[model samples]
Target chain A: SQQGEEDPQALSIQEGENATMNCSYKTSINNLQWYRQNSGRGLVHLILIRSNEREKHSGRLRVTLDTSKKSSSLLITASRAADTASYFCATDKNTGNQFYFGTGTSLTVIP
Target chain B: GAGVSQSPSNKVTEKGKDVELRCDPISGHTALYWYRQSLGQGLEFLIYFQGNSAPDKSGLPSDRFSAERTGGSVSTLTIQRTQQEDSAVYLCASRRPANTGELFFGEGSRLTVL
Candidate 1:
């Protein structure tokens, strides 16, 4: 499958700590995006890093991409209970508009 | 709607029945997508629509699953002869035609087949 896969299916962290999740895909991509889903419903876009870029940061979230390795990682600094959610990585391949998503990482922040 | 909107947030039906899910994408967005997620599972790509171009239904699991985007705006996903395995949350998302590639999603429609 061309879908991406996330490592460490689940993670738990204390408030003020940092949480990290990694994703690996199998094909060339135009860009990679991170999304957060609360209560298993809609997913909210977090960040996007083009294949040409190595890293990008948005607010408390930081994303890094290594196209040669076909891997990407997301780091949430100063985690909070409200940040508990499933994080997904999506890849937009160079050939199409469809974005394939990863299995996702479930995150829990202890208050 | 300020964001993508979906109808019938939850639905329960018997096996062999047919069901349709609706999605209203954010106005002016030209790209729309459908995905299904089972409990504790990853999102499964279903279909994609980009403006007036023909939809890419390559990810559809079977002929029993089909989707249509009308006038490049609203979309509908139909499931025929539903099975227990078809019980899942169907999510819809839309994106602007710009290069950002960010997708805005709806709350999703949950379907249960018994």
Candidate 2:
């Protein structure tokens, strides 16, 4: 079963706009990580937010976690045409080591 | 390898045939994972391996799917008697042990079952 489900199955926005996607999970997680996929090949890790951490940032990426709500969100600042891709959230359950991924959010950035 | 490596960037097979996908993780990484992604779908966790412990196979969709890791370095995912539904990209990733580290992934093997 998928542990997380991302909102806004697909989104379209002009370049330079900020894109935000949300993921909701069922159980407590050791960490929540976001990834990007281009052309549906392989995923590239963007940022990881540990359970104890409420938020984290890396370059143009920002991630926030709310354990009480069992949800996380990924924010891409200043989105570019190249940033158009599918984004997924993976949660590592605190009860186990396995990571479960959510159905991705497909973002289309129009140049 | 500097990053995770997967074999046969693409594979096309007839239904009912068996196929094997291989993954070689970065040196010394003690954790590895395999996932399947269908067209326009998110990754479905298939299996996970950590060190020499028994793998977590709970996510495998069926008995026809099996994976094994050798020497904690390379891993193989074998799908027996493939079905049309098995057509998807198989991705492999590796991460450091017992840490909140990011996973390093390979350019997945695209499987086409006809």
Candidate 3:
């Protein structure tokens, strides 16, 4: 069973615009991490926000976690064509380290 | 290896045939995981290995699916009597310990069941 659900299945935007993706999970998590995957490749870890931490930033990526709502969002600022790819949210429940993944959000930055 | 490694980047097999996928995790990572991703679908967790024992094999879809990690380094996922529905990309990931650290993944094995 999928533990998380991500919204905006697909999004297209011009370069320099920002992209936002949201994910919601059902259970309490040790940490929520965001990952990026290019076509035909494996996932690349982007950032991890602990349950106690509300927000985290890395490069142009910003991740916010609201455990109260069991939801999290990923925001990409100054999006570029190279940022075109699929983004996924993985939640590691406090009970274990196994991370459950969401369906994912596909973003396309048009140059 | 600096990162997790998987073998036979692509495999095409006939129905009823058996297949084996291999994963070699980073040097001393004690945690490893297997996941399956179908066409444009989310990753479905298959199993997780802590050292040589698997505490969670609950995500395995059927009896045909099984995985094992040896020497706490290399792992293998085996599927018996493959079915068309089993065709998917098998991904392998490894983490350091009992931490919520990020998982490092392999390129993945694309299995095609015909």
Off by over 4 Å in 3: none
DockQ of 3: 0.83
Error of 3 at A33 (Å): 0.4
TM-score, chain B only, every model?
A: 0.97, 0.97, 0.96
* Tens digits of per-residue lDDT for model 3, B32-99: 99999999998999999887564589999999999887778899999999999999999999998766
Cα displacement (Å) at residue B112, model 2: 0.9
TM-score (C-alpha) between model 1 and the true structure: 0.98
For DockQ, the strongest prediction is 3
DockQ of each: 0.75, 0.73, 0.83
Ranking by lDDT: 1, 3, 2
DockQ of 1: 0.75
Report, for every candidate in turn, its global Cα lDDT versus the true structure.
0.93, 0.91, 0.92
Candidate 2 or 1, higher lDDT: 1
Off by over 4 Å in 2: none
For residue A16, give model 3's deviation from the true position in Å: 0.2
Number of backbone-clashing residue pairs for each candidate, in the order shown: 0, 0, 0
Query: What would the per-residue lDDT of candidate 3 be over residues A1-111, giving only the tens digit for each residue?
Result: 537999989999999999999999998888888999999999999998989999999999999999999999999999999999999999976765679999999999999
True contacts kept of each: 0.73, 0.76, 0.76
